[model samples]
Target: MASATVGVGWGWWGGAMRIPPFRTSLVVSGVLVAGLLLGGCGTGTAASEAGGGGETQGPCAASGGAVGAGAERDGVRVVGVVERAGAKESASPSGRVSERPGVSVTADSLPGVGAAGGPCAVQYDVTNPESEPFTYTITFSLVDEQGRAMSNVEETVASVGAGKTVRRTLEQAGHPAGGTLDAGRVRILDVERVPSDEAPAPAGSCPASGLRLTADQGDAAMGLRVVGLHLENCGDRAYSLEGYPVLQLLDAEHQPVDGIEVLRGTDGIPMAGGDDGPPRPVTLRPGERAVSGLAWRNTTEFGEAVTVPYVRVRAGAGADPVMVAPHLDLGTTGELGVRAWRKDETDPGAGEGGNGRPGAQGPYGGSSTS
Candidate 1:
């Protein structure tokens, strides 16, 4: 068999819908983030000690409870309530005061700083209203005092038990090239969760399925986009994969998106890298990963843009499906290309971030069509 360097068509996404509606995002200068930034951060909710007469004064300080607003559609909800980071809601710094957790969005976490070291940050209080433990991926967007959009961010919380609540601070990802951001508004955008045992990870405890599946933030320059879908054998057993990885795109509502095309190999959108050969059988051992891709171009003209927020992936037949949020914004291109499964050449070091493996990407020797 020849070592086919192969198909140039790169990626595909956004399922069918009757002429999707226009989608747009606003990214501005760091000035917005900085202006919205808080003075400092303490442990949880309001960061303050004792004040006059055993009182506590902080940004999240109790003033008839935190006040703000958010939107909830489908199963996703964005309500404002402060709790200790990664702690249960039963313990908010707003003086505890037993009460049912409210679903109203508020600005209690406003002007907050997160690990991102930038502005446009907010905290989330995740409550697992389910019966068993499950993992969650929550999406958030930065808004201004007037509730205009600024930036978006996402956080994945693994394994929350029934009736348990956890909190996390998520901030805008990076500085946009040019524009202006509204100060200090972050709200939940979406949330997609799955069973804890079925959640995918780059590296961690072995999954019940024997393999781990994860998605990498692919590159996007101009209108071209490329995202990597990876599968690694984490269990003791070897896993066999043949043909293309199955994919299902979902909207913010977690409903199936229709009409978008998923093409075999990358011929639809011509590109230099992520060449695809015919689907072939590949086996992965412990710590070994396989790489494929979802690529497309964001080209819109009159027609509404398609934005896919979630992708449910099955590495092989009968394999458990793991939901990943690559947030593909297919701008009316209508077609998406997927590369076939191939052996990844990236080295798995002492298990750093995500499965301990690295991506060489194009010409980096990270992937091979052998």
Candidate 2:
């Protein structure tokens, strides 16, 4: 079998829905500042005893009860958690936590500083216990080596139906200052339940012509590369998209790459940014934009080179197909991965900080590949 990896790119057109990667780095940065204030002093250790007869407790000692590896609360259980280094491409499974009856949650090791020092990524597995669908938010707090919380917190929304399990990964840059994060100290700050049917109905299918696409190269490590896809609604009315886009690989001549496998986010592709919940209705008004994540690996243990020059994408079922030349070079793997569309606040379409309204350029200007 051929070794495979994934890649992503971004593009935009007139009156069309262009999907772009979400700007979670800014949120992480802001949260980091807030966390610093809430944490007061930085990680500090108390002085040792003069005679060394007894050890003095440090202020940075773990306070809150550790919640992982079989910890349960309010009908929810924490299976296990792991910490990953570098980009997710090189991430391997560790710290296995067994599943039990009732609702359970497990966190994959969150990414540390990438090779380029960008934000770390996180993936979570959430299982719903009830027969009905359940929507809730999960938050991650950075902890120091001393087992004290740091100045950074990241949260994502997740929805799982009864007896079903859903996995979600954080896309976007994360900057958790103060060295490596303590995987054991990382605990769930809150998990609020929300309405399962919160998503609004779509006005109609988004016309391909009304959407614009822009592609940009993103972070890479361990032979894995990321392409940021930005989709904007140039049409006059609102439009919505749920689920992953249909991606077909293309050769240098823009022809389909034969035997290339396209993997959906649910297929175990580690994604950054966006929520893990059921496709929420991201109703974009005229000029609003959304984002999607794409990843691919190019390294091969042993095989011929797999060259992918272009990619053709369909926003959703029945939407017109748009061809984008990401210029990705996935050598000999013949595999590409794509994530579902999520709202992006970094573009001009959605006003600076306001939701879905026209705003100023966010921390990330027009587009960012990292």
Candidate 3:
């Protein structure tokens, strides 16, 4: 008997409240709302500090720490070391439902077809470190292997900024796919916040690669340093940078010096989806922006002590090709009197005409490689 049914809500405290994740093939149910202050009137303590109606104490019992209803009676707990969110954690994306305090969940990962696995991603950090301004709500859950029920995720606005420590992402979206669920059996990750007016939205980018590398360029030579990629199209439709980028040259011991003529193409045209050339298209109009740069040259030769030469980029489309390894002091870029010969021993246009000499075009008859 396996099952699935989940629904939990809290929109700034006003409406939407339906909680149920307590199944029974083995017993699994979850609920930890923090603002109604036990109002249906059960566990005592002036009905949870007048939250039952004498009013004025519900800020989780006026923040004075353990203010009633047994502090949490012993079951729900997953805040883990958030003493101020300042120690290491970063990764963000997927948005459109926010209210910062931090934490949201609706997880799932189970026997997942034989080896055991499912559920993960339980991170949180909001930061009102303690100057005042604070709001919260964080919920996350998952259950399988006889417990019957599987998920009950929840995220309802969060705001904590007096000292600043924002870092939060919760999307384990019903986990339970197989192959041992990829071996990480996440039981039930967590986070919750409450104090509302809903305000915490900013997470979603790569909007067509609008320049974001943050600093990591290292690979040198008189040329082979293409660290300039900036494009933004936000998406409503319109994008085509064509494609023909595969520049490689790594010698000075980094190896691979065989033949040297790696320019790809520029004036002789030929530069779109190459390997055979024929489908070159470039059009962008929907908030428009595009810029490109990549050039290489280091045939290797002249003193030959170059040491770890670099520059590797391969573009076939969109984005995902980066390898810049800079580190050369070769008499400061003259390639240090280079001399490592190959490609049949130079002179194909020595000063401009020698290799295939016929008015010079000696990088091997370029017309998309005739």
Candidate 4:
């Protein structure tokens, strides 16, 4: 496919809990991830970057694509223009048009890949400089020139090794806040890092306990919010569970959220599709999935409003604690309600309708691409 890409080094700030105080529209020239190589294109590297501040390579002599990329900050690089994805372009006189490479770009819209595309996405390089492995829960968003958030995507990068870096492509969910934003608006909203041992096991990975854990993006209506917590026996052994999962609300910095009480079940907060049924002894065989839920109200009545971005969960006593990001916008309610665990009976392959994520195995078991 034809391409239009550039490599440049730009830096930005990181924040906690919610969106950061400021945002950066970075143009990175680097890739640390290993993936399918383009059939006719050379692999990209920061060391091969061109443009200002370094030795440059003009657009690939034959194709206009920016052949290389550059530096990273806070262990991340937002490789400028990736897989242009065949979007029609009206070159802004300064765009590095893959179909006509050699042009330099300070800013331009990526028709189907950026704000022009219904789904906003970004490529991120996350590195763990610490000696031990760590997992990161990174929040990415699209914002307007006003700096107001248009849409947000939360993702988990599991087990980044000490001094090693990995890359991921994250996309926003639903129609999003602004529906669609303009170009150069992708920003890093927040980053929370935790020791791998303390982080939740990803859905496909089997931890020592032989189970995997994950939480949904959640839904809210009329100030009420509900998020599903999923657990599966990814290993060969059967796992047994009874009662509600233990919960801990955490701030962006990973500290316990104060003042919010953890209610035992959803009775305190009512909502549709909520399971108020009794907890039953459920044993999940290999490939079996169980689900629990969380409920809360974001009604602001007084004092200070609360927004928790993390939750530490354990299936039961003696089980490992898994960190889930249900992004509790608890308002000033000071309470979070939990639901008992029950075996999931939904067909694994069912789209679950609504805004489905691209491809199968997409996060949240989404059946379709959003």
Candidate 5:
């Protein structure tokens, strides 16, 4: 079953009823990730220590807690709380007992190319809830769909005391010019507070190493290849995902060898899943993942020049999709560049230009490339 959808064409998202309303208050403050290793600070780090005194606290489920069927309408899931909304909630810092408050973090800009870039920024509203003097260890990192650590930078802030909110912004850097975000591995890593003096040392173990790519047999014949992608989820909740899925390819110079913006189906339609296709409305229970395959043609004369492919996949609820473009390396090969059939261009490449894969040509067809 294809997942239900509330499509809001690119560029124009807010005006449409399909697009729900969400506040963009992502606060972040840090430079491009530093040389910290990929592993997290481990579950035993001082930062992991909780101070709520292990009290039986109110329910804090993932953003997409299962609500009654009717609660989910128009692609937006409405969750209810046993108590009044916006009730006072207390979160302790490791073991310290001070009400040093920080501002809420909200997503300000998303990464992407061709109207989509892969880099995104989360802005923070740092506030101090306590009256005494205090400091905070502000950190940022990339987490995978399964809530595993990808990378991070451990930074600090001194003297952010009671009744104040400071702002910080976190950003994923080095994204290609234009691309999509990998929705499955949307990187909404963790952001929380820890007592500055007790900040834990960085962890250096990897949950999963780098991703890998493999192409079908037809890839060679059709001159098509899959590149890399930057994943992201715009929803308040995080998603879970598996597999090292990727996008189209690019040459060594970072020039896109395949200019295909979106993948089309056999009927010349673009969607992640459809009828008899991958399951649609794949609701990756919050903080989950959903992977999709991306393919593209050469679009140019094949030669000794090497090519790299990348994609900027993006996703978010009640917000415009955030795009990130990562790349793949394809060694040199011998083939002509791919020719994308314009809305009205003659066939001039190996695969048919209609949908998914290109079509087969008739044995005796006239040659026309105008």
Candidate 6:
């Protein structure tokens, strides 16, 4: 028996035992090496595909399909998306979409998050279209252009009377880490209805006793001074506040200033924690505070000077009014404006500041009104 030479070339089994010619062996080895390389590349491509072609990255690209407006699922319709800084986008529901009787949902404009720690507000108009009252848990997600959710899926439970609408604002903190919130693409995650009798009782109104009202005047800009009305819950129990604080300017004689008119409006000045709906109840525990904004213009176009030596503030219509001697001078236009109550950055629930009550400062953190 003749001993055969088993020559190795580049880890290939070749060059012996009546194997093919050297050229043929080289060609075979090359094909084998190329095949291995191709296989490795194929594996990488498969891995990429498994991970969504590597397109879904960051916080927004979570594990949910793109949910468009009016794309009903789980018994709810996203009626519309109101962008805080943009226009309203209407949702077009599919013909197959069927809403649960006495259940409807709508999303409202989200105010931009400010330094004082305000949430992107979603005003939901939950309606009971039927003749009977119902309670429901409405779940939704604020998504970005990449179908990524900017905030966690939010849910709010409410009771709606028959053929009536109950409006509430759900606050979502923080923006998408990577993409912009596609306000037009809000998704309704779920709507679960229950018997009205099982619904939780509505929160109670904030009484004047538990609340301490203070005012802080912001820096004057363009003849307009902004005043932040701070309401602190001084009592041990939680208190809820909704709507604007009743305000009036007082002259040096401690009398209501003549020729001054307070207008209720939402525009003309930017305010932190401002929301665009009717007063929504804000529950404040002991030491917690909420803020409402006020603006007064002093300088008239004719250069007339308007000055107020004091201000009177009432938490609500029936609350006893308090007089504040802010001595803030508005250029003599005798016109003022106010914003609805909203959670301030210093709110205990906001978690931006420590667990102490917020000082009486304007939205811009100016001097204390006291």
Full ranking by lDDT: 1, 4, 2, 6, 3, 5
Model 4: worst 10 consecutive residues (lDDT sum): 6-15
lDDT per residue (tens digit) for residues 117-166 in model 4: 32222345677888888887665565654866755555667788888767
lDDT of 4 at 177: 35
Error of 6 at 121 (Å): 53
Which scores higher on TM-score, 1 or 5?
Answer: 1
Candidate 3 lDDT, 221-240, residue by residue in tens? 33432222223344577555
What residue runs in model 2 are displaced by over 4 Å at the alpha carbon?
1-208, 270-275, 347-370
lDDT of 2: 0.45
State the lDDT of candidate 5 residue by residue for 221-267, as single tens digits: 23444321122222355344432232234442224576333333222
Query: Comparing candidate 2 with candidate 4, which one achieves the higher TM-score?
Result: 4
Q: Global CA lDDT of candidate 4, please? A: 0.54
Error of 3 at 135 (Å): 23
TM-score of each: 0.58, 0.38, 0.21, 0.58, 0.21, 0.37
lDDT of 2 by residue, 94-192 (tens): 343556788443433322333322222233456566676655544444444565554333333434676665544332223345432223444555443
Q: Which ten residues in a row have the lowest lDDT in candidate 3?
A: 81-90
Query: Where does the lowest 10-residue lDDT sum fall in candidate 6?
Result: 40-49
Q: Of the candidates numbered 2 and 3, which has the greater TM-score value?
A: 2
Which run of 10 residues does model 5 get worst, by summed lDDT?
36-45
CA error at residue 244 for candidate 1, angstroms: 1.0
Query: What would the per-residue lDDT of candidate 1 be over residues 165-191, giving only the tens digit for each residue?
Result: 664444333322232221234455566
lDDT of 6 by residue, 1-370 (tens): 0011111111011111112111101112323323322321001111211122323222222222332333345334432222222111211221233357796543322223231012122334565666666666554655555776544343444446777654343334234433233234456655545445433222232443767665542445455566556676766898776777887776754467777677675454333233365667777778766777666655556666767766768778876665554456766555667777776544243312211213332342322111
